[model samples]
Target: MDLSCFKAYDLRGRVPDQLNPTLAEKIGRAYVAITGAKKVIVGYDIRLSSPEITEALSSGLMAAGADVYDIGLCGTEQVYFATSHYGMDGGIMVTASHNPKDHNGMKMVGPESRPISSDNGLNDIRDRVLEPFANAPEQGRYETLEVMSAYVDHLLGYIDAGSLKPMTIVCNAGNGGAGLVIDELEQHLPFEFVKVHHQPDGHFPNGVPNPILPENRTATADAVIEHGAAMGIAWDGDYDRCFFFDENGRFIEGYYVVGLLADQFLRKTGGGKVIHDPRLTWNTLDLVKAAGGKAIESKTGHAFIKQRMRDEDAVYGGEMSAHHYFRDFAYCDSGMIPWLLIAERLCQSGQTLSSLIDARIEAYPASGEINRTINDPPKVIAAIEAKYSVGAKSVSFVDGLSVEFDNWRFNLRMSNTEPVVRLNVESRADKALMEAKTEELLQEMDRLNKN
Candidate 1:
């Protein structure tokens, strides 16, 4: 086994080479062995390789004396929902999640849909999968299940159906797994959906299904403007993370969405704790405080965010990368719930999406996350820390290097899943300062790269 395929939070690698059916089967057996799970749930996305990998995984699980329940061709969160909602022992979803078409991976969770990350037995499973073991004398059985209706019902539970306005919503699934769910959901919604690339095509003919990239965002934005929709939403390959654009076809930074959702949840629940990542803070902090809710900072990554939410009993948590977690949804991130809640909020308040966040955007001007590929991430981070810590009011190594002053702050961290350093800067309603600092940081990174 090429252990490099294992990541900090999940398995992701180039397909057939780093990950394939053979490795997936071994992983499936090891998962059962590690968790002692008697009943396992398996699901896959729209990727061409996913169905074969799911079959191989199920075979291994059954061979290891564990019964398998297969929920075919679904999003990543469906596995989470099926596991926790049906009281299954564990679950795995075969998805690369916005990676290149040549790549594939798996996301695993234990009972109650708790993630099993590298720190939490993923490495042990990796090691165990390498050794040979005999199959159980009595092989377990496999069964097929349908979870969409129940899943749609759960999604609708997050908002009142009657509260939705007869507005037009532009939905661009990017030819990924989100289309299926959107199609199923439309039957129950009052809004008209302007669908773009709505079919699930593993070929990814419409692009790689990642709206976070600037190049991939134009389709949704254009559709929204052309169709005169009230809002636009785009999802990644597996539909775990969602990106948003306002009625004017302008993309809203995910940082602002975090604050927006935090405000919404606080108002609904009469105020509760909210968790956010350290990369971007001021907007979320101000909104959270204004809503009479506590704001807690957590390390970035789904595993860390979910665990922190569980520990704090937070009513809501959001990452600027578009992952939103809710206390009611087993403390797991869902791409579907965030948009539903936003829709409901717009309807209830009779406000445009852009109008809702315009003030907060002005109050906390930010440089959206920028990424640079470097030879040595740790050395670059150390250099940044050495340069900034001298004049900073506070410095934190919570996730990476976060230096804070009274008026400006920034966090530079290495991505867990990619070979790059990400930088995010924000200022107290000063866009010029934010841009100047962002440029300075980029120049510094360039200097280090040349050296």
Candidate 2:
């Protein structure tokens, strides 16, 4: 009866109390009833409760006359890949991503792997869960689907494997599902992988696999330095988003990776549109333009970026948060594809990752997303916007308040789920100015929050 798992983009909540096999079954029925999906590809992550929940969900799907193709023990993107790769009617991934271990949720996609978010059929399905469900006269069949070979082939297709030479790379799976795919890919690639926390353990011994947190990054960084790796990569539990660390063991900001990927992808395609988030722009814009590609800004979030990629026919889309979407991959974000491309870049260029990123950092210094706990985020944002907009060369609100001047720019946006204000500031080739402006802005926000 508790459907609190439904969210703006996907379903996420504490398990059983908010999400259980009983509720998952009803949700399966509601999903089939609302979306009219005849063939649904279902996948689950490495969580203790995932198998049970997935079984109940499949039962409901079959009961609702929708055949189920279960892709067992996979990442969220695998569901996205299976849905579009097989031309299925829809797909659902049972994953809570980086949420606490006791929590579980689902991310759903309709035909062509388009997201089914709150504005779309997600809300409808949530409402339908409250209604009675009658089984169809003919129950749908259930079958196991083995999509790894095909999915791995698709991932490798994004890179020039022949150009990839021998190199040592560090990949920290954080005891999530990414290690499974890395094992599969290892057979084909020449790169030597120093695997850390590499296993699909639902128990999550090294914590919850979220590499974004500073504390969670130490293991990966330490391994990269200890092993003398070319670069290090880390992924969340479901492996939809991946984080990067250079050979020097410094965690590269995701914003820089966005620019690097845009450049790498654009070179292969000759010229194409690159979708990016507005929080940090100068570096991406510079690289995109130099690569002879057009840059389009989209509001942050996977659904928004994916939709924008589809609309613009973009070759690649990336967010500072580490979600990279590819046109060839049905406009879905993939943690696997980004790293493969980076490996290829390193192999072909014969340059260290830090050398490539350092130049760009010098060109555009950024405050890599600072978060502040505020009582009234909206009031603080509006107040900050009013004061900062006075002499700004340009101002816009594609996602939040973004103000630009000749030498410096900053973006202040409130978190959708919390009373936190996220701020990003950047300066043209001046880290000192960027730091100063960041400090000044933080001080102003603090001053406004008190008022």
Candidate 3:
């Protein structure tokens, strides 16, 4: 009822206070009213609070005269697949998606798995739920089905590994929903794999499986080195993003992976358009163009990226953060595609992961993306633009504030769910200039943060 639980992209908050069953029930009733769906599929993650919330949500849906199909414990993507595969009118997945354990959220999908962000339909749902708790409409029937295997078959359809050469690999599911997907894929894939922390432990005894953090990546990197494997792969809580470490235990930047995937997709589809986030994407754009494909740049975030992909009919898309989407997969981002393509490439070229991505890292040196907390994000963007936008070759305000010099560019965008502004700077293999410019921008941003 507080309504703050309705975030910019999804319904997420610090649990009970911001999100609870009372509100969850209201949300379910409101969702049915807004989407006008008679049947809705529901799925949830391994979070301790998920089961309780799912049941509460079901109660609300049934009260709203909608039948509920309980998909049971599953990852977010599985929910997406089920939503579309089952021909349900809509679906909801209870997850916070790599957020801290105490935090939980829900991601909803409509027919064709269309996302329901705040701007889309979440705002309306929020408004309806805030009005009052409504009476029960009907006792909707409930059904259960194990969807993991069906999801596996769906993912496998995107790529073939039967012709791939044997290579040792390491996978770390990071005590999240990743293991559920990886476990099924391992049995069918031909590669000799070494799995690290593949079990789904909600306690996250090994720490969250977020590869973006150095601490969370230790196990994956160690496994790659210890097993002397070709490479290692890691995923976030919902397994929607995948990151990698090369054979020597060196963590590869998400930018390079974007380039690798761009190249692979181009080869497979023969130069269709590709979408990428501007923060760490020039390399991907360059590769796409060289492969005779057009490149389209979207602002960060899966919601925006997928929208652009649908608009442009892009064959593939990637974010430096390791999210990959395929046209063949309904233009939705998947955490399961990257490693499969890597394995396919390794088999095709008989090359190690290092050899494949080495040239890309060297060709496009990056400063690695950084985030800065600021009191006034718009004021900071104004200050940076005032100081650096002069005489710049070009500037674009597509998602946030992006300024481009002849050889380097950076975008400063505020986080939708936090007070921090993310700064992503990239130069043409000029590490020194990138460092200097990064410091200058950070100093400017810090000056604004103080005011």
Candidate 4:
């Protein structure tokens, strides 16, 4: 009944302490009760604690009179796929995404893959689980299902090998669940892959299995350099987000990947809508517009973007954080889709990854997405707003806070689960203005905090 396991968009915490079998069971019961779902599907990542949690959750769901479909050991998207694939009432994924091995979490979706955020049903579910209930339904049952192979088939269905160009690429799974996909992908795809940390080790002896960190990215970049690959790709624990490294061993901002994928998707399905987070890149907006497709910008998060995608019937949506969603996949984001399309683009253009993103970097230079610690983020944002609101061309609070000018823009937002403010600055190829504006904003944030 300790509700700390519930988070902003999912249920996540450390094992046994913040999370355990008892807690998972309670969550399952509460989820079924709140959603009124008669049947539910479940999946998990490659953590040692996953199996135990999955079993406990299933017990809870059955207790609540929900028929459970157990899809053993799969990525988060696979659960999303199953929820839509089997026409189930709801689904749950026991994963922490890219969180450390010590951490685990759950993501739930109602019918139609609609999210259960704190405002919608997560808080209600938490309240239900908080109260002790001894009696549960006795007429429920569970069935096992293996959908990984089917999920793989769906991934390949979106692209053709004949359209894929041959190139050497480095891929680092960071010892996460992506190894399963990489192992099968090397044999099926046309690219020559240089592998690093491809084995799934729950201990995460290499690192936390997140390509976002500079340390975790070293192996992937080194592999690209060593093999003289065209590029390097890496994934987090759940393989929902894919990061890229150019041939020069430079880590490309995921925002660029958003643009790259948008361009590719727009070319295939011209004039379709493309969704992107507002944190970084006007390049996405430009590319989408230039390609004759409508650009829809949303606040930064998977839940918000996915909701918008369904509402707008967008063909594709991507966030600078590396989550990519496709309309054909029931508005679910997959780490597998971005690279597949990139490969297709390379084949069509006969260009390498470096060549693909170089023109974008020159066209729309960025401040490289920075995160900073601040004791009081609101005070900093307030001060910035007060100072800039007088003359700013526009000020928006769609996600956190964004202020726009004639030729430059920046957004400073508080992290959902941390005491840090993430800042992203962009300009129309004016490097000096971007640096000066970034410094000024950081100095202002520091000055206000020290006060």
Candidate 5:
């Protein structure tokens, strides 16, 4: 097994090269041994290589004396749900999650569906997978199980199905695992879903299954405008993250969605702590405080966010990247719950999706996360820090370097999953100022690159 395949949070690498069935089997065996898990749940996404990987993983797990409950083709979160719901010892989801078709990986969770990140147990698994081990005397059993019905029930439990309005909503699954769940959800929802790229094609015939890229977002936005839909929803390949667009076909930044959802939860539950990432904070902080709730800042990334949420007993947590975590959902991030809650919020307020978030957008104009590829990320980060620190009122390193001034602030940090530095800037209710600062930062980044 290539140790490089193991990342800080999960196992992700190029297929057939960095990761393959052989390595996958070793990973399975290692996971079982490391966690000492006797019973585990395994699931795979709609990727061409997933079935083969799943088979190898199961073989290794069974060899390690683990009773494997194989939940056939599923989203990443389904494995998380099944692990906790079935009271299993652990779970693994075979998916690359919006990576190129040539890429594949795994996300593992221990009992209670808690993540097994590098700090917790991933590194141990990596070391064990490289070492030799003998199989158990008697092989454990493997069984196929269906989790969709229960999964759908769990999703429905997030909001009142009877309260949803009968309005057209655009759903662009990007030909990933989301279509199957959306199809199942339709039977239980009142809204009319205009499906786009709504098939589980492992080939990803419709561009890479990521909606965050501006080039990949046109289809969903156009569909919303063309159909006069109330909103548009899109998801990554594994359906672990969900993105939203307003009725006017405007793509809503996940930053505002954090505040919107936090406000909704706080209002309903009568006030609780809301956790937000450090990337963009003014909006979420202002909204949470206005709703009589406290806003806590957590580092970015699912494992970190979930851990912090559990620590604070936070009612809701959101990353500006569209990863929403709910305390009720075992503190795991879910792409399905955010939309359902937003739809329910729309139902209760009797307001259009666009109208609900318009005020927040105006109150805290932000430059949505802008990613830049540079040879020296650290040098640029240092340069940006030096340039801003002199006049900064406050600075933080909760997740990344966030420098705040009297009316504006920006966060610059390297991405854990990708080879780029992400920058987010926001000004207190001033779009022009936010734009100017964003440009200034970009220019600085470019100058450093030239040097």
Candidate 6:
């Protein structure tokens, strides 16, 4: 019983060896035992091993006296959508997300589509998997649940579809499950979709669908330019997080998208809280305030952002890493919703994506996110903090060490799962200053690492 597949947020590991039908079934039963979920929603991604694993998981749920509503061959958000949409007791998505193709995993959520991560129920479920399971007094039933139509309708509800005008939009699914969704949404919109790597293939001929990787972006960027699209969008394997490319075929950093989405969502809500991560702030803070919305910072990661969204009753939440959570969608991240809202903005404002983003970039120049592998992340980060905090106007540690001056700020935080430290620096209306400060910080970090 190698349960190494269980992770901080979800379960992810190599197939068969670390995760297989055997372990999946146990996880299913353990999930039921821990959460007391009677009616569970089960879904899987476009992975090669997903069907068999999902079947085993459903069996375990059934054996534990929890009826299963199987939503087959969908992305992770679909599970999130179905659980809250139909008022299921809980939901589990069998997906590795953007992990390597050979790996598989699961994302679980309890009632109201709240995440069941390590601190809450995931650890309990993992421990329970070690125990023996008994057949329930009555077995739970299994039925295929067709949630696509309703789910699509829910997605379209997020935007003004009538305002969407004719334009060429590039969508590179990267052979992941997002294509299925785009196909469903295509009929409702006025835009002409330039589909690239559009088919849902677990084979991932275009390579794992993680558009965040610089190498994986070319296909979408190239297609956007080739088709002269208004904009381009790409998604990870499970499509929970989506990346964007402007009309000029340039990849837009997720931080900018966060600001854009915050502004767009705030307009619709009239005025509401917009939740954001601490790693990068000034841009989002500016946009959020300009939209007449208050900004709240949460520690990064889906669980933290989603929980914060629930607590604040936020209209929308976003991370520089591309996860966008919407309140109307049960505080769950949706790769689809962000793009539709952006399209609507484009149509209504009659502004190119680049023009909209460029102004924000000029207002707040950022170093993006830079990761450095260090032998001692804590020591290096602390030392950097000591040196940088001397004349800093403010310093805080909501998620990481953020030291701010009048016009510039930088945040250095250790990766939750790795020895790498990520650094992000930004300056108010000064790209040169931002670049110079970023270089200085990286050099200082490297020097500290050597010491």
TM-score of each: 0.96, 0.99, 0.95, 0.96, 0.96, 0.99
Which tens-of-lDDT digit does each residue in 1-451 have in candidate 6?
Answer: 8999989999999999999999999999999999999999999999999999999999999999999999999999999999999999999999998889999999999999999999998999999999999988988999999999999999999888788899999998889899999999999999899999999999988788888889999999999999999999999999999999999999999999999999999899898999999988999998889889999999999999999999999999999999999999999999999999999999999999999999999999999899999999989989998999999999999987999999999999999999999999999999999999999999999999999
Q: What is the lDDT of residue 209 in candidate 6?
A: 84
lDDT values for all models: 0.92, 0.95, 0.84, 0.86, 0.91, 0.94
Q: Between which residue pairs do clashes occur in model 4?
A: none
Candidate 6 regions exceeding 4 Å error are none
Error of 1 at 1 (Å): 3.8
Ranking by lDDT: 2, 6, 1, 5, 4, 3
Residues 305-416, candidate 4, lDDT per residue (tens digit)? 9889988999999988889999989898899888888877777888778888988877777887788889888888888899978788999888788899988899889999
Output the TM-score of candidate 2.
0.99
Clash pairs, model 2 backbone: none
lDDT of 3 by residue, 28-138 (tens): 989988888888999988888889899999888888888998988787888888888888899999988888887788999888788888888988988888676566546
Q: By TM-score, is 5 or 6 better?
A: 6
- The reply for model 1, stretches above 4 Å from the true place, is 417-419, 448-451
How far off is residue 365 in model 5, in Å? 0.7
Error of 6 at 308 (Å): 1.0
As a TM-score, model 1 comes out at 0.96
